[model samples]
Target chain A: MEKGKIIELYRKMLEIRLFEEKVFELYGQNIVPGTIHLYIGEEAIAAGVCSNLRKDDYIVSTHRGHGHCIAKGARLDMTMAEILGKKTGYCRGKGGSMHIADFSVGMLGATAVVGAGIPIATGAGLSIKLRGTDQVVACFFGDGAANQGTFHEGINLAAVWKLPVVFICENNLYAMGTCQSQVMLIKDIAERATAYGIPGVSVNGNDAIAVYETAEKAIKHARHGNGPSLIECKTYRHKGHSRFDPATYRPKEEVEEWLKKDPIQNLKRQLLEKGYLLNAGMAQIEREVNDIIEKAAQFAIDSPYPPPEEALENVYA
Target chain B: MSMHNGDGKMRVITYRDAIREALLEEMKRDNTVFLLGEDIGRCWEGAFKVTKGLAEEFGDERVRDTPISESAIIGTAVGAAITGMKPIAEIMFGDLTTLAMDQIANQAAKIHYMFGAQAKVPLVIRTPFGGGVNIAAHHSQSLEAWFMHIPGLLVAVPSTAYDAKGLLKTAIQGSNPIIFCEHKLLYPTEGPVPEEDYTIPLGIADIKNEGEDLTIVATMFMVHKALNAARMLKKEGLGIEVVDPRTLVPLDKKTIIDSVKKTGRLVIAAEDCKTAGVTAEIAAMVAEEAIDYLDAPIRRVAEPDTPIPFSPPLEKYVIPDERRIIKTIREII
Candidate 1:
């Protein structure tokens, strides 16, 4: 990859890390209501996969979806407003963090239900194939969702039809607080993809370049009408399942070991060593990002709440 | 097959023929409209023969059949609807809706709303409900009340042949998800339906028999029973008014209330289980809103809570017959 492209990817990863840190702080101060599922350690997976996608390519996200939205080019201020329950948000404050969607950018929508979006993305791909378009759909789900019935049905159907969809699984190793080992006997989730007669690969999720390269190949194969592929990214989350979880279920050594491979820090070090970003340049980028987030926070705080009567407005049609 | 104008009104047709005509007309009107279900296009002509000749007219792609997996059938139709196709999925039996409740209630009913109205799920789920055919409990059940509890869905129940065609046409053209409940016994029943194209708006109630002594609000097959009860009570010098609220979700409460005010008594009849059924709901609505206008306590003539039995005697004992409906109205008055 080019040095300039690598720096750009690093910058995107930094924006996501700092944005999530700010959201965590505001959530602590009671500025945002409702529960939130953070995407702190999963930044590389989103940034890497989305870097290879075109404007018309589609993506369906999970409940921990902010990183995917930002990486897919959704405006940070609008997404923040949505999280704060403001009318100016992507869904007019009706859909909070878990349900953010911008169809104009081909981000179909995020579903809070586990594995529900898989068949939806497959159906979208079916639409593309029927229209004779080369467009592909990238469906993102957690390791927990792999056990859902929709996962089996959706993947099998896509494989049989040769639909243009890339099933990206971010294997954070836990479904809520339960570890992956407790649920499945197999060590690698991608290995199950072979049962559906599809190519499956497990990649180092902490390495942005590896994830980007894997996703690029899978997406290219899908667009060329070869078939669907299952690409599992091995990663970890810095926070618990949600805002209320303290993550007591996980061991201390595991957390410590995974923290050492933080994708943002790894990319930052590579960019600095390669002469793509000097100390001054890094400081300027940090300042600009901070100012943008500050404006987003103010916009969310100032936006109005939806009218009470509007509750019954969108029930039908 | 000659068209006739009696009393300067459109000619009469069978309810089954009306439904088939609606499907034919809608398919011609919209290229995206398609049909899918089990034996829907078979030469045997559907279970009730509503989709009799559609397969030959539109070809196999437009009129398709499927394996008996209700979940897969409904789920695939949902998938088709969201991706720009207007699919009319048929659930062969109303009792079978239980097998696909998750897809119907959780997925189809909630997708558009959960996505913040970004997409419109224009799908019609048609099923035959009610028990009078002696087809036993598993095949014959009135489950419209179960769907009425959901918020983002429209429920339409057509009683007359004209309504069977008109309401269906309206449902196909509408953008929201619709649950079109047809009565199994009413398929071969005939009534006056226009030969030309026409549509009746949903959520509107039709007053079949207007009188002064008592008001009877019913749906589907029960509407015919209430009218029959009114005829039997006429010899006894009792006046009975019959109201059929075609759609259950957006119920025509105003029309029902107006009829009750004029009659000063109300009796509701339905083929569903007596407990928490459509009849009970209508009775409760009247008790809550129009209690002051009532000269007597509201009455409900409905099937017993037990399932419909295969034996003829047992089934007759369980469901509300015309005699039971008449007795209930007499007690109320």
Candidate 2:
């Protein structure tokens, strides 16, 4: 990757990390309505995988989808407004955090149903092939989703048609407080791809460069008319699954161990080691990102709520 | 083309042929239109043969065959539809719709509103419903009411070949998602259809048999049975009007209420279970808006609240037939 690209990736990762931290702060103050599923630790996967996509290419997101939307180039103001339930947000605040979508930026809405978006992404790939377009789709899901029936049916169909799609599995080691090992026997979720007759690879989710390179290869393969590829990023969730989740289910040592491997910190270290970024530059980027986030939050709070009459609209068209 | 045949040549076709013709005509007209379902290709030719020979004509891509995965089939069709493809997804049996209800009701129907209308899911999900031929509980069902209750869904239940062809065409070209209800028993029944291309606008009811004593409202196969009851009543010096609401969601309340106003009596008949079905809604609509016009209590003729059984006699007993419709109508008039 070029120097400018790595810096860009680091910035995107920083944006997700900061955005999530702000969400936690707001949630702590009880300012935001509804619970949020944080993507604090899996920031690299979103930043790296989305780096290879074009504005017109599509991606189906999961409940933990704010990072994916931001990485896909959705405006921060609209995303913040959406999570704040303001009319200025994406979907005009009809969809809260989990359902944010900006069609213009290739974000095809987030689905709360686990693994439900997989077939949707595959169908998008089918649409591209049927329309004779070279556009590809990136489907993002968690490790637990791999156990769902849609995961098998969707990936198998995509493999059958050799559709232009890359299935990115963020193996965060847990599915809503349940460990992956307890849920399924398989250790590597990517291995499941072998059954579908497609290429499968596992990567370090904390390492932004490795993730970026692996995602690039898989995206290229799909774009070249090669069948879909399943990429499992070995990652962890830095916090509890959702708000009010005390995480008493997990051991303290495990949480601390994963915390040491924070993706944002890892990316910053790599950038500094490569001499691409210095402390002063890192501090400067943080300041800029913080300012942007502050403005976005203000925009969200200032935006008006949709009138009750508007709720009756959009059900037909 | 014009609605009427310029040469006065009428086409006599079955309900199955009309559905196929609609699919063929719409697919040929719009490149984005495609069909997805189980056993719908050249090999199996669909469970009912409604899609027979479609793959050969349009190629496998357009007339695609799918596995028995109901949720994936429906969800994938939803995805394709929102992405600019006009997909017509079919569930082999209407009873099997329960298997894919999440996708049909939640994903496809709510996406338009949930996404703030940024996208529209132009999907037509066609399923064969109604009890007949001793198919048992799993195969035979009249579940149109289940879809009608959901918002953002257009429900079309056509009783004749002309209505089926025209409504299916309108559904494919329509911007909203539609639940196209095709009756299992009506597939082989023949009706007069125009040779030229045309579409029947949704939310319009067609009066099958005009009468004066009472207005009889029905849907799907019950429409024909109600007409049969009206014919028999005519021999007894009683006149009844039979109205078939082509689409249930955008139901033409005006036509039904006007007919009831003229007749001063109304009888709503449907093949679905009696409790909380389409009849209940129409009855309430009439009672709310046209109560002053009614001279007697409204009547509803529907299947008893029970699952269809395997025994032929038992199955026939549960379905709302001409006798049941006539009994209800006679009591009302």
Best by TM-score: 2
Residue by residue across A40-63, what tens digits does model 2's lDDT show? 999999999999999999999999
**Candidate 1 Cα misplacement greater than 4 A, ranges:** A1-5, A129-133, A159-162, A269-284, B1-14, B36-83, B132-139, B307-312
Segments of candidate 2 deviating more than 4 angstroms: B1-8
User: For each model, chain A TM-score?
Assistant: 0.98, 0.99
User: Local distance difference test, per candidate?
Assistant: 0.85, 0.90
Writing each residue's lDDT as its tens digit, candidate 1 over B255-327 gives 9999999999988988898888898889888889989999999888888888889888888888888999988
lDDT of 1: 0.85
Q: Show the colliding residue pairs in model 1.
A: none
What shift in Å separates residue A213 of candidate 2 from its native position after superposition? Answer: 1.4
Per-residue C-alpha lDDT of model 2 across residues B234-323, encoded as one tens digit per residue: 999999999898889899999999899999999999989989998988999999999999999999998889999989899989988999
Summed backbone clashes in each candidate are 0, 0
DockQ score for model 1: 0.36
Tens-digit per-residue lDDT, A1-317, candidate 1: 78877877877887788888888888999988898999999899999999888888888898999999888888888889889888888887878988888777778778787877777677677667655788888999999989987787678767876889999999999999999999999988899888989999999998998899999999999999998999999999999999969998999999999999999888778888988889898888888888888898889889998787766667888
RMSD of each: 3.5, 1.6
